[model samples]
Target chain A: MTDLLPSPPPATRRPAPPGALSIGWARVALELRLFVRDPGQLVFSFAYPVVMLVIFGSIFADREVAPGVDFRQYFLAGIAATGIMLTSFQAVGLAITEERDRGDLVRLQTLGTPPLAYGIGKAGQVVLTTAVQLTVLLVVAATVYDVPMPDDAGRWLTFAWVAVLGVLAGTVLGIAVSSFVGSARAAGTGIPAVAIVLQFFSGVFFVFSELPGWMQQLAAVFPLKWMTQGMRSVFLPDAAKAAEPAGSWEHGTTAAVLAAWVIIGVVVCARSFRWRRNAG
Target chain B: MTTTHGAPALPAAASGERPAVQVRGLVKRYGGRAVVDGVDLDVRRGEVFALLGPNGAGKTTTVEILAGLRRRDGGSLEVLGEDPAGADRRWRDRVGVVGQSTGAGDALTVRETVDHYARYHATPQDSAELLDAVGLEGTARTRVDRLSGGQRRRLEVALGVQGRPELLFLDEPTTGLDPAARRQFWTLIEGLRDRGTTVLLTTHYLDEAAHLADRVGVIAGGRLVEVAAPGALGAGLRQEATVRWTEDGAAREVVTREPSAVLRDLLAAAPTGEIPDLSVTRPGLEDVYLRLVSEGASR
Candidate 1:
């Protein structure tokens, strides 16, 4: 049947796909470049948390959860956790919604972009930007608020895993929610509202021990609570552990919850992501 | 219902020619109403085929199904030797699509956007050459959001062809362009055709189809009313000429199969050698197209 037509030229023969890894890196580079070009997004993702930390850190400077464990240090940890979520969840959610609305995702799909590569590209942007945001937050906390860095290698290691897992979980969840959003405008307000409410529930803006027992239980079911606790474990003094709701840093639970979210978010994102708005 | 004489019979797959695209009984439904009722079409390799229709006429829907961007309720279809429903990345690599409403990433500059799309195909066209061909070289450094609508469209075309696909789908590609830019865009499509790319373009403009398509399909009311060479469409109607003349202080007109005979009779009746305000003209493609569309709608 194929022989009925004259043979097309050699170049017309189907070409093998450009390798997935290469495509993924290309997407990552492009996403990063775009992220940098949008000054509004840059300032919101990187600067908002730093600004919040300074304003709140100063208000609670002298209060201590325990002797030698300043309340400002505890607030610093929560602000850093929130910064990771801002960069990963909020940034990714808003970008995906806008892309879908603008038909950009449909354009990419038509070009035969590997779906995995596209996901990797978004996640890569989240990771890189979250890293930068985290660095700025940490630097500000240390220099301005006089919050000390994690002195031990183990504490630093904890910080690394928590941040990585928090970002991954947030990135995938962001993508998953992006599909359900009706438009970029909806996502702009909706995603941040969800983030802020989670912050309140997860004790980012309040002391976990002081929150109502039901709110603490409710917060335990979500990842942000674990992420905040994990951040506190790394940055706060060892004596501050007594002030935790569990009376100690629940490192094991934090790891399990964040990792589980990463897995669950990936599944949800894969199922929910759409190339076009209002697509069947 | 008004299939033209030049329309091909549904040939077997092993027949004389392997068409780049073939559809039979294509159907798409929205809330139980068939937006694309039943569409049958064929586009041979290395030829430019245009689908002409009015708004809500299913042109975009049909093209979307062909491009694998939308699903059909029922149909037997083939594009680039594969069913778009089951088409994979390999099939996609060979088929380029410039969707009617879909657009590229707006945050990236024109060159970067082109470069990004090029990475999806194994062998892509040179970015500089593509930009120049689409008349976007001067604006390559400008962010896509900053581009004028026509420039953005030119950029869309640049991305669509960057992959050098065997088949290209352009949906209303010249909708917003100035006449000069539209002509330039037509030239670029001609160049692609010269390189053996089979193009399936959809447009409401008769002149665009008449100028570029080797064959034009007139679709209306979710059905293909006719498929013929631009000049040959509604040929039977075009054969009859309309003759008009002034007589007895009134304008008189007659529709006839032979304008010469009518002119002869009118001249003989006139006392003067010259008939007053006389004209004999046949229907152009535009008239035929409008007639076809209106007829298709009524049916």
Candidate 2:
């Protein structure tokens, strides 16, 4: 029997002209647009930290047992440091794993977009989102909650360096963790679980001196502790140093530890990162 | 469509002229066993080359290597006169690909998806014109996740050709398309060929190969078993014709190499001048394909 449908007319459209932007810029723009359109991502990256800051700051505002420091100022610095970790680690890790699970990464490889472009776009998004989060947190801390600002230009510079170091460490660590996770769901849970434990022991929730000796040492090995301590040194008064064993800010040591973590994190990320989830 | 009735035939690849794509003694191994054996292929410029094989025959692996997405274990390969193993940005810009699966971002609309890919090439097609050419104008604002399978496939084709590539790879481009959609896609592909774009397509649908390809290659067990025109594959297979008719109110059929001879016989048998419901049928490309694949499987 003859088929009833009419045959389609031959196509007449012209081919795309040669000469366009490089694929790298196209990839970055696509990634940025997608990330911004996802409302859940925006809230988690920019709002969650502020919510935590307010709740934790209010709860610890009146607890005056620690010597030479007000609890609110100390936690504010710790919360800001934790916010950077959240953006870098949880944000980057889960996003990468989700994209992999969805087969987006594999699609990109076949399209001839280099793997490095994908990673760079992801890192750019994390850094931009973290910067916005930091700005929001600082505004709330300074204007609404009466959290003290850095006392001098030098202290402010130190705070800036600490934030940068914290974000770098977090981004590297997140990429590494994403490479290890089996699925997007696992990444979601695994990243936050590690972040919460680190926050508790890194003195974001309590003074590090109150922790057991081994717990203090264990926390010291992590980058979060150094980030928190460095931020506290910038915002907290000198009298607050009395609670610690040294009774003074060890800015050099904190800087060195964070720098070392950054190096190790970068190595792990580069060595372990996979472009496709199925890549062994 | 304006047919070129007297256009000159394209030149064949000479001994020293560079083939659009060349692969020699290519091999891909996993766990000590080669998935793609020592297969060799040559695709000349301005040719519609179809690579046909059954599932798990390593067609995808071969395409991936040609696309510069995977490394070959042992081979000398060249695409566009440069080694695909070390193809740089310039070489990449010359190639376009539509993989077996739909690879566009599902969250983006059709227009946005086309626009985004356009930026990847030094020169890209206009988004609206590309969409119209691909029959996607009505769904430009619709999200990819919401499009039907056929629409999504069209979008995939649009993205593949957005760069106006010198060479294009289509992996199972019409796998899930309805007959109408499939025919529409073929028209778009023909347009690409008209513009001097070389196309390399892989499909299980033999009709697709027969209709669109200038030459077809059968790949079996990771090897190039045979390559010829779609009608010329499987020697002696298409030589026979099956003639069917009604004799004395009952159906009758006969197979013979010469249908004209059979038609003469049918006219002699019938008392009247006209034969009853006569039809002459030849073996199709699908028959040759199945026979070849089954024979390869047994071996």
Candidate 3:
């Protein structure tokens, strides 16, 4: 073989193996750099939620969700939840669909990127982007819009776990659905439409209690609704609980629902996922 | 079908010259039609074997099977001595693929894209040098989407060699490159060959096969029709050359194998000792290829 390849295989393909952690980090670093370079994706993932918050926050300014809290604070929490979905689910779904269509996943497979490393690396992108997007939303809400920060240590703990659960559910769902999108261009329409549909029913843009009972039941079945309620529990004062359909945070249900979605995503992805070239 | 005689197929692993790739009775079906029907092939290590076929001729399908990128319905394939069907990372790491450039991560810069691919190999070639060799150093920071078709093909070549893999599969690697860039790419493949990398390539260009392949395989109707050295392909069909010249205020032409003897005879017979605008030509790979494909189509 050396006659065909002047260098020995041991020198090229067989050095001390890159441990799983290193390969994962390399993929994450590259994915993140690519995400940052695309201005359209940057604006959508980082700033779209803030832009939505500002527009709706002002329009609902005079309205009040509870005695002390106004629409701005109410929207602050819901929009933060929406930011997680946008950055994790929508962003990851679109990117993966496009990657699958473009043969990116296939190329990586051929290059021998370990499947675990690739999976972890993709999840890393979702986690990183959602973290940054949430930061941008919370910063703008607390600073520019006068939305109050969480004052209790336990509240921030809830926020952390909720964010993690929310992003996990969202990104896992994204990976599962990406296999169904037939082409890259089709993703532009499919992902945003699903997001919008979920947003409307999930009570991100409106009060969950005000929705019809059937819609509320439908919304309850989805992670976005639970994520929104979970974020509200972290940010809203106790009085705002009056506007929640359950009259309390329902923290147990939120965790259960999000965890269920995660399992469902994993199972569905295992069964139906098609990555790589079936190109004839 | 396109097996050309050069040296005998190099002795197998027992001879200290392993076959880089071997296929026996390979089969692949789509909706019950055989796309690749019972293909048997052998590519000796360090050899440049070009697979040539018209569209839908199973060339890509066979190459894909060899590269471990596709599954076969039946039959056996061994690449680097391991069946690609169950081949693992150790097998993949030694195989470099320059696939048809549907292109993934087009948003990544040329440098970034090549660099990411490099990490997959244990000891890749210098990313910077690879880019420069492909004439893409100027576009290193340019996103892949910004590259022209030719430039992207160059990037494909750059990444193909980045791994310094023992076996490289190049599928239509020069499809969109300009003549000069195609030549440049040929030079790069030659460099890889000289470095001892066994190459299995597929191309639509007969000239590319003529220029780069040690042996060329032609496929048609899901089976290999012939594999031969380029000069040997059309030899038996029409052995005569065409000699054309202007004489006596008119054009004249003759078909003969001995063009030089005819030229000598014509020069002696000419009153002015000249045959104007004279040329001697023979059939080439293209002629053989078109005949083979058309013959296959009719059959």
Candidate 4:
């Protein structure tokens, strides 16, 4: 059993680095710069939430609903939820889908960009956006409305976990939706359309308790309701729990519901991720 | 350049032991129809091989399969000594793929895009230098959205070669480029050849193939009908010369083997010793390509 065959030549290029940090971070830096180039987009995504808070504050000015609490204080938690969903789900979904339709994702595929790096970069963007988004909502609620800022360490700790979980829910849901929304035109209209509808159920503009039974059930199935409840746990006073749909912030249910969504979104995104438009 | 009729075109030949690419009985099916029906090809190291075909002749499909961007139904294919289907980031770093119409990162400046892409490679060419090489240095600060179609294609070329890949897959690289830019692209391709990079380009421009490719593969009906050096492709069926002349104020056509002798006889018969409105023609690579494709299609 003697065989003789010529071996191939050695490859000319050097071995690639272990991870995609160098490449992915470069993409992030480039996208960050691109984000700044369009002043309108920056203002719309980051500043619009504050504008929304002002409108809500003006409409609900100082009613003294819960001893010292007004309608604006009760409304603060819901608005914070809306801001999270807006940036993490709506903004990320639209941006990623646009990139996919325009073949930017495909281009990244050919350039040896590790698949996860794209996800990480996109998630990083959403995380960064949600930070600014939440900051503005908190600022307006505290400054204009004279809402109490939590000095208690336990309350602040609760706020931190809730925000992190809420952001995860939003970012993952955005990625999953990008798969379901195929073309640029559909993505452009579909994402915001879904957001507007979600707002009605999630109680961003009105009290979640006031919504009909069917609407409450529908809203409970989504992360936005849980996000709103979690924010209520952090911002609203103890007695304000009377207004919640579940008769309290339902902190345990808030953690379970958002965590469930995180798992579902990760599963859907795994199955639906398209490397190319024509790819089955 | 005086290679034998059967010899592969040596566009700054490489002395490497491995061929840049090899495929055997490659097949791809779309629903029921086999778009790439059993193709076999070999491109030597450092050779500029052009796959010339019509729109649906599966040139792009075959390139996609070789780039590992698509899966084949059945085939044994290799690029840079590895199966493209199983290629990793390391494998991708050693290659490049440019599509016919690519759109991405339109909001970034030319310099930013180039610099960003170069990060994927271990030791990529300098972004400024790559832009300069592709004639995009002047537009380095220009937004990609503002670049002309031709200019954007140049930027793609710059990005494609930034890795200094061992093999480059260009699917209609010059489609949107102007004539001057096309000439510049050819020069850039030649520079890649000097660096021992093997290029597999699919193009509709046969003249582009003729000018740049060391060898041309005319693919039609999902198969390669002919593969040869551009000069040798139509040498056989060429009934030699295509003679045209103005006879009694009307254009006339004839085919013959001995064009020089025919012209001399025409001059001898003419009283003016000048054959008015006469021209001699010979079959080119394009003629061979058309005949090969047409004949294949008819079959």
Candidate 5:
């Protein structure tokens, strides 16, 4: 049969694929560009944290936690934690759900995009945006509210490790949550609401040691509480450690909990991430 | 002709015989009902094969299975010489799919979207050249969300072929296009055909099947009724021409194999050499397709 028909002109040999890393990097660039283009997402992800910081910082301008640390300075660390969650977990969940609903993920799947590469692209975008978001929050704190930057190298290092782990845990959890959501609209409302409620429980709006015993125990189980605790350790002085529930920063527990969540979130993401909302 | 389950196997010339796609007893069911029931088909490489069927006749389901987008409940199938269900990135790189609806995201510009997807393939057509090929060069800078429906579909085609796939599956590519856009789309597909891309398209429109397909497979009731060249469909029906003429102010019609012989008798009986309103017409593919579909419906 086919032999009887004139054969097609020989296909030219194609170059080997640039490999998954390059494709993943390309996706990162594209995702970032799109993120910048959507003003709604931009304001929500970047501005929400900055605005919260300013509002809380202004309200407590005259109040002081100790000899030098103002209440606004203490609140700034919690706001930064919230910012990380906003950009990584909440924003990522919403983006994935909407993209899945829109069929973009399915299109990429058909295009031979490795799921790892897609995840990399998504994680990269969150990392970049979250960095910018935290910078803006810090700038507002340092310049406007007379809040000092971390003076020592150790504090800066703690900030770096905590930020990386928080973002990683949040991003993976976001993707995993997207797989469970049935529609973009549901994710849109549900993810942000979940983020806000977690903040209340995790002591973002109040000092952690002052919260009720049951609330403290429940908050300790979640990543956001660990993230807020980690951020506070970086911003506050050694004397402030006495105000923690354990009378110390509990750096080991913070690191262990965040790392555990990262592991759990990765496992959940690998098992649950879907290319389409209705995927079987 | 209405149903061909477990159809006769193609003769073995096992060596050097590779169809672009081959399926045996393909079956896909939802709950208790089979949407695609025991379909067997072969699409030769580099030919445009159209699976023509009415809405919900399983054309899309069959095409989706062959494209590896959907799973089959039971079957043995090969696409581009690989089992699609287990096909890897390498296999996907050789296949392109233009789905029934547009899946291109609106956030990126037309050129960016094309270039973005092009990165997925080892060898991709140039984004600028592909846009030009699809007659969308002018709209390259336009945001995808802003493009008109027809333009959006053309961009979808550009994205589909940017991978330079050897086998392309188009599921009802022109379902909603206006006449002019549909013709323009046909020309684009024709260009791809000239480039030797093996195309498998599913369409409910008979004229589209006739215009674009080298061979059309009329499928109904989740089964292929017949697979033949458009002109060769419904062999028995094609032989019988419907002859009509006005006699004594009454219209008379007869179905016959030889329209010329019937005309000769009419000519001899008429005192005047003119046969009023005489018309001899064989059933077109559309008629044959409708008749075949009706038979499938009844069964």
Candidate 6:
């Protein structure tokens, strides 16, 4: 007796092709499209900051906290700084933690996406979202809130530079914080907790001089203090600077400190970041 | 023929054939003990090679190293003729991997997921054709989170092949699939192999290995114990055939090295024209697999 079975087809051999795109723009487009599909994330990213700006603007309306510097002008720069922090630190950090928990990072690793590509994609998303947030806040400030806009090219350029710096600082800090937080829930709370505390001491809501000496020293260590201070330099006059403890705007020092923070934040994020939850 | 230790030596792929993958003296350690110990392997182009192992047998670690996701402590490894340790993006585009972790974005529709990956490769397969190939045409508009496990797995396979990769790594590609889904997945894999795709698969299911693999290698206790064609893995155990017959109003059993000889003897003893309820059985892949694993454990 004999038994016969169908034979497998003969193997066909071919050479493999080369890989492409070390840090491709297409990945950024993909991330942005996915982000927009989440209604909750979209609302929180774009609308939350604008709503806070409105509520705070109305509460401080018609008040002159410093001579020749009204509450509206003072709060405009502070609100913009806060918006950068919210979008870059809280938003990016929580999203990364959620993706890590969901095994998205592990999946991306298998696709041979270079690690630098992931960072570039994330930074692009943060910059784009922050630009929208800044535009909405500035429009409301200028048209509805009766805040003055910068007339000179120098001041407008300064405002643009400060916003860019704020974004870089916030993104680096957010990625660093994300490396330490293990779970999405912890990240959600921890990000907001750190942001709220920094806001208080950085003089976003109150005068920084009123805080205790040790508290003032602690706040100076954070990038938010220098970020808001630099933003205020673009919007406020020299005489108004008298109210600040440093008298004239410390523009040079603020730029230096913020740049240093950006460097430190990047180093921390690189050292501590893990592609997977259980990765060694 | 030149023999090594009185065993028929298998010929390695010839020089200039360009193995799809090669790993020599590979080792990985955890908690001061090696999980993968000095394993050597070569997979020829377009061959369906299966790695069979029990749970916690370091199969995952080995595959991860080949996929360039993990670093090996000691090994000379080459994937697609380049060292995976330092291969560039051009080298990566040649390989595809479907791991246990799913890469699909939960919010994106199935079509979007396939389309998004299509942009990453220079010569990607058409999105419509990829969806049809994976049997996901109906679910193209469905979000990944809403799809069933089988659908998600199919989506993963679609993404894995969209790059037109020459080498594909599938890690337990059929786990969690129902029998019908498993059969369907096998067809897709067979199609891929037919298209000249080299597949390196790891599966716990013996039937899956027996049905798809041209050659299977079994690993136990951090070591590769044996490698053979599925039918030849335990040929010694299959030497005896078991014949069962109904005789004298009772079931009778006999084991013999030669089934034809035994059948002739039984026919002569019964004196009956017809043998009642006659059945011939041989040892299967599962039986050989279980015996190999048990022996490995005992040693």
Say which candidate scores most in TM-score.
Answer: 1
Structural similarity of chain A in candidate 5, as TM-score: 0.93
Q: State the TM-score for model 4.
A: 0.88
Candidate 6 lDDT for residue A93? 89
The best-first sequence of candidates by lDDT reads 1, 5, 3, 6, 4, 2
Let me know the DockQ for model 2: 0.22
Worst 10 residues of 1 chain A by lDDT: A1-10
TM-score of each: 0.92, 0.83, 0.87, 0.88, 0.90, 0.85
| Model 3 agreement with the true structure over A75-111: per-residue lDDT tens digits | 8778888888888888888888888877777777667
- Using TM-score, rank the candidates from best to worst: 1, 5, 4, 3, 6, 2
Segments of candidate 4 deviating more than 4 angstroms: A1-13, A62-67, B1-16, B240-281
TM-score of the second chain, cand. 2: 0.80
Q: Looking at candidate 2, what is the lDDT of residue A79?
A: 89
Residue A1 deviation, candidate 4, in Å?
A: 54
| Candidate 4, position A145, lDDT | 74
Residues B1-299 of candidate 1 have per-residue lDDT tens digits of 11113333344667775789989888999889888988999999899999999989999889989998887887678787777877778778788888766766667888888888778887787788778777787998998889988888888777787777889999999997899889877887887887788999999999999999999999999999999988798998898899988887899899999899987777777768777788998888888899999999878
| Worst window of 10 by summed lDDT in candidate 5 chain B | B1-10
RMSD of each: 4.9, 7.8, 5.7, 7.0, 4.8, 6.4
Q: Is the docking of candidate 3 incorrect, acceptable, medium or high quality?
A: acceptable
Tens digit per residue, CA lDDT, model 6, B176-294: 99999999899888888877889999988889989999888887776777788888887777787889999888998887789998888887887857888999898777877887867
lDDT of 4 by residue, A1-280 (tens): 0011111124653765447666567666766676767687689877887887788788778665566667787678778888888878887788878788777877877776786677777767667767877887788778877888777988888788788888888888898898888887899999999999988888777777778989989988999888877877787788878877768778888899889998998898888877676772
**TM-score winner between candidates 1 and 5:** 1
Q: What is the lDDT of residue B65 in candidate 3?
A: 84
- Which DockQ value does candidate 3 get? 0.29
Task: Report i-RMS for every model.
Answer: 7.5, 8.3, 4.8, 10.8, 6.8, 8.6
Clashing pairs in 1: none
The runs of at least 3 residues in candidate 6 whose Cα sits more than 4 Å from the true structure, single-residue gaps closed, are: A1-23, A58-63, A268-274, B1-16, B240-282
lDDT of 1 by residue, A149-194 (tens): 9888999999999999999999999888898878999998999999
lDDT of the structure predicted as candidate 2: 0.78
